[model samples]
Target: MSSAAAAVSAKPANSRSRVLLASLVGTTIEFYDFYVYATAAVLVFPHLFFPTGNETTALLSSFAVFGAAMVARPLGAVFFGHLGDRMGRKTTLVAALLTMGIATFLIGLLPTYAVAGWLAPALLVILRLAQGFALGGEWSGAALVATENAPQGKRALFGTFPQLGAPIGFIIANGLFLIIAALLPSDDPSRPSLAFLDWGWRIPFLFSAVMVIIGLWVRLNLVESNAFEKTVKTGQVRKVPLVTAFQNNFRELVLGTFYMLATYVLFYLMTTFSLSYGRAAIDAAVPGLGYDYTTFVLMMIIGVVFFGIFTLVSGPWADRFGRRKTLIWVTLAIALFGLCWVPMLAEGLVGVMAWLIIGFTLMGLTFGPMGALLPELFPANVRYTGSGISYNVSSILGAALAPFVAVALWSAGDGSPFWVGVYLTAMAVITLIALLLGRETRDIDIEE
Candidate 1:
């Protein structure tokens, strides 16, 4: 090997710290920017953006706008994935973070339905699409950078650094909301009272700037991935990794997308749908726990803490058991766990806590190995393009419509959670089948 090539091959002492810190911090900001919207969609958007005064239509419309981001995610994946593969993962990662940060901050500045009429929602959709697109390439790139930098035989455990972002982001986002909600309490159920919709909620959205700055500082100091570095030195980088992924890696894309559906389904249902249902008016046509808003959020805080912890724990589990094997049992556990939705929800707050604990635990397990499993499925040349696109594309199948569909099912069953549980079960079953079909690549060499 040439001196430059040898330098690229020889891992630096600081590379692991740079990789893990960048992955964890960058993705935490990314998902933090993403999830604050999910929380708003359930708590504030219907009144602020839609303002129809009719419950179901307004809620559905809010979630539809929420789903709009997911629709744009695949396109973002294609664009950013191409950039990451061709140019470099660091460039794409930086760009994606900037796009997300700027867009989220702007959401704090948006005019409400009362102020701008139809233009309000139009602008919201546009900004949300921007967030989804930037996020498309962000996650897979973070995963690739971390796993690629890992020592042999520990990729899954190392990859958890990026995966840790999801729960960390979840906790931070909800925790921020709780803090804001404490400072500005709103008691109206039909509406959030102007105080919250007006300025309180924007605190979290505008706070994206600080998070972005911290993430950027960490990422900018980072070393680039060894895989991409090696690919560059070897002159193997695809001219357009997006096109190359389509031509050769389509199967991995499809299976990987399906394999992650259960994770998405469980997440949205537990977090977003639960928030909406738990605080919904008990007498309404849709089923709900009707817990006080503050109380339900407290339950969520507890759930999210467990979510964050298990995410870290699942990493070593994946490392020891093999990614595929761990995922298979975990996915199956998720499928069976879905059956508990009825009794669990029926048990009220305790049941809700139990339900959330189980779902988030399974979520951490199923998702922890994904950062390793996804990029490992692709060749180094197109790994970023293939893995990023597949991962984001799955959002449409899994998260995009999950809350909307869950509410629709609840309405269908006259406030029953029966059909919603069925939906969760089915998504989990699909993920299990995909796991069974996918090749075990835990021992596969990522460099090739």
Candidate 2:
């Protein structure tokens, strides 16, 4: 090959690595903020933001606030997806990181219900919406950045890099909270009160400032995505990417959204519901060894490490087996695992460990393929809008209602957690069917 041709090819490969790195770091921080709020919703928000109710009611209210973020996600997706397609990917990603960072940092400063009454929960909901909107833009932009810049024949593998950010972010968020909880003095008769509510809970939210600065610096250095650049050169950028996406890619959007159901439902079941179940079981004198709240946090961190490893593994497997095939098998596995929830949870600490390890492994496999699968289903022109809308909409349907539904089911069942397992299993079955019906896009030429 001529030197000019060789140099041209080399440039994009080098740029792709940088793009992947930038997207990975920024996405990790964004999700760190997002998951930090989720963890707080379970452990702290019920006490701090909605302190007026009984335990169950306060927990339900906390999850309701959590759902508010999911509700705003689709709106954020539509707004940012338009800008990303028309203006550029780099610009949208940078803006998303800043929006999430500022909102999360400010959450640390908000007054409790004791000080602000109804206004405290009201303000929390508004900030939660801002966080949701920022995250709505985050995934699609990061996925496009990785996929667009990837080397030929390796898009699936490269695409998983950004997906890796989710578990890493989860670990960082949960790990920080666990550390803080550990440092506080126990409230048992033998120990002094550590005053967790007075100060400890705020530390994790406050630390978001450090991550935000680092994420912004990395994102600012990234160049616009090559797919978007090609759109500009060809004068094919959509004036209303969301409209165009709906007009041309509605079928794929529906399928992608449903295909994500199992993952989202399983996500909340494993993370949020497990925390509540573990704590309640411990307090109720269940037969098996019980875990304190902090123990559950530590278990989740362990699950995240496995989550990252499986995500890495799934990318190469998807490239070899095709996205649809890989996803179908993973979805089926999740459905089957959901059935084991009650039995496992009943077994105490050992059962919980087994449950998390198995559940998170499946989560990794399915999540890895999704980064490539959803975007590849659409043509490059509307990829940002199509993938962004489908993803965030799925978050609303699957994740937003998960905690609320699980709690209601548990209550109606007279403290039986088996009903929660059935709910998650149903979502997995839907995802399995959706994956079976979807096309395999692993070999589709990206520029098409």
Candidate 3:
């Protein structure tokens, strides 16, 4: 075939629906696997894997392991980002999905500390690392898949398809756990049932296999996006995307990593830390709101509904107002929101629910544009590596430490969440500074 004919032939036959579905499903599965582990880190791991005798110590240990995964994420970014930038997004995305699925499924089968001793937590840490690694690559690829195939002026809007996965995944993962706990009711409503602690928690991890299969089916049907195809045809594919990313786009790398800082911290705080805080008995050494496990998860699910809504809503706003400008306003709101945590959570159920709703709403707004903005920061030659590294490294700085730090701050405040709110505001301020230093990415020609 002639060069022109080959170019025409290489145009993806994938419909818009297929592109959106493939991107959305892959991330849904990825985040579902992640949120399952996050929920388990709060609900089960402290009891099963880390028996430190003290409640606070055990929970801290579980969170430490959870945070360890964040350390592996940047490494995953380098490895899989290389594959994606050089090999193509389709195969790399499939590999990432498979990796995360296998790790999550294996987590369900692992023996608890009571059965296997120290080796149990050791193995859990390894598998958690694998999950983090896989996810490091997953988001960038999904974001690329969505934005690259978007029609003119719609990249930001299309990008939200993948961003939507966070709330969707959170709902499914937490909702399933709530259902399982409800079915296996213990005499006390506040704590997890014995059955749930023993086996029900594993169900969510094992269920990942089913979702992975569906994600694989959708992603396997995808063709490379035209933006990436153009790079391939032009012979612009980098031999070492990671190195090239740093060499050519060092500023974007720094900016992108910090840009996501507030989102990471707020999300973990809302889901993991809040679950631990909301459910602890009011008279405990570290007092909490004293809600039951099921009730708190339900509240989080309700809050996540706003997360999903605002995620989609932010997309159109980003497309219309410019990604940077919209995100600047959202980040500022997140900063202000952080200051209100004390008053909000102190008000009882009405106050706590309002706090959750508002926090997650801001999470959606801040997180939505990143699907396009990060990828748009770099040209196609190293976009996968650049964005993946930035996103995951921020996971280490922001998410990996958020819960652990919040727990410490909560203890320091003598059960008050004031210090935790301060920590969040500090992170938000960092994100805001980064945003100010960065350029608007809404109009960037990603194909270049």
Candidate 4:
């Protein structure tokens, strides 16, 4: 090998750490920016963006707008996946993060329905679509970067760093919202409502600007993954990655979609439904639980901590035991946890806490190995497109409709939360079956 080529191939141990940190932190910020919008969609967007004549209509419309991002995600994945595979993962990720940050920052500045009529919602939808598109490209690039750079026999464990970003992002996103909400004066008819509407909400969204800058700085320093470099050296990069993924790895793509269903469903329930339920229940029964909004945020942060820990734990376990087995066990736990949702919801604060802890633990376990498992199932040439499409397609079927479906089910049953649990349970079962049917990819070679 040439001196330059040998130097590139002989990167020091610290290089991997630097690359992992860059990928993890960049993804965390991207997810944070993305999820902040999700939280707002559930809690505030209905009133701010779609203040129609009826409350139900407004809420439904907000969720509809939220779903718009999911719809755009697959498109983003295809476009960016192609770029990553054909161009380079680092280049694609930088572009994706910039797009997401700009969209989120703009969202903070948007005028509300109260101020701008239909134009407010129109602009919000456009921005939401932009957010989804950016996220679509972000996850696959980050995951591939982390996994591809990992040491042999440690791919699953190392991949967890990128996956860890999900929970960390959730923690930061919810924690920021919680802090801002707590600082807002209690909802008083006498006091100016502008405190929250005019400014408080914008704080969380505008915070993305700082995160985006940090992400850009970190991402700019990252080298292209060694695996991608190897692919380039072998002249194996595909000219049409999306088509190649579909043609060669269709089964893995389909299975990946199913594999992600349960986690996605659980995520929406824990973050969106649980928040709304906890807030409403607290408002009605236990005022001393602190502000309903604040309590919900704290609980979410608690869940986020467990989520990160469990994800880290799942990494080595998956590498040892196999991704399929780990996934099946986690899916079963999620299914069982779903069955406890109604009982837990009825038990007040303690019940909610137990529910979140259990749910997030399961989330961590299932989510941790997925980053490596999905990519391992496909060949390197199609890895980016295959994994990207599968992940976002699952997001559409599982997460995109979760809040909306959960709410509809809740309304259909006269306020009973049981139906929401049933929906989650069913999705978990789908994931369980998919994992059972899929081959274990734990030992798959990256360059295969």
lDDT of 4 by residue, 274-305 (tens): 66555543233211123356656787789879
lDDT (C-alpha) at residue 322 in model 1 = 86
| Highest lDDT scorer | 3
Local error of candidate 3 at 161, Å?
0.8
- Looking at model 2, residue 317 earns an lDDT score of 92
lDDT of 2 by residue, 1-448 (tens): 2442333334343376587788799889988998899988877788788876577888899999899899999898898889888777778988888899889988999998889999999999999999999999999889988887777767788888888988999999988887877787566521113476777878888999999888888877776655665676666877888888888889999998998889888888777777776666434422113456776678878987898999999988998888888888888888888788889867766888888888889888988888888889888888888888888999999889998898888777767777888888899999988888888898787776
Measured against the true structure, the TM-scores of the candidates, in listed sequence, are 0.96, 0.94, 0.98, 0.93
lDDT of 3 by residue, 95-142 (tens): 999999999999999999999999999999999999999999999999
Q: What is the C-alpha lDDT of each candidate?
A: 0.86, 0.82, 0.92, 0.82
lDDT by residue (tens digit), candidate 1, 1-448: 2554565556454377788899999999999998899999988898889878788899999999999999989888888888887777777899999999999999999999889999999999999999999999899889988888899889998898899998889889988988888787776654465688788999999999999999888877766676777787888877878778779988998998987899999988988888888887788777478777777878887887788788888888888888889999888898888887898878866777898888888888888889899999899889988888778878998899899899899888888888899999999999888989888878998888
lDDT of 4 at 222: 77
Model 3 spans with C-alpha error above 4 angstroms:
1-11
Off by over 4 Å in 4: 1-14, 188-193, 281-291
Q: Return the candidate ranking by TM-score, descending.
A: 3, 1, 2, 4
How many angstroms is residue 219 displaced in model 2 relative to the true structure, after the best TM-score fit?
A: 1.1
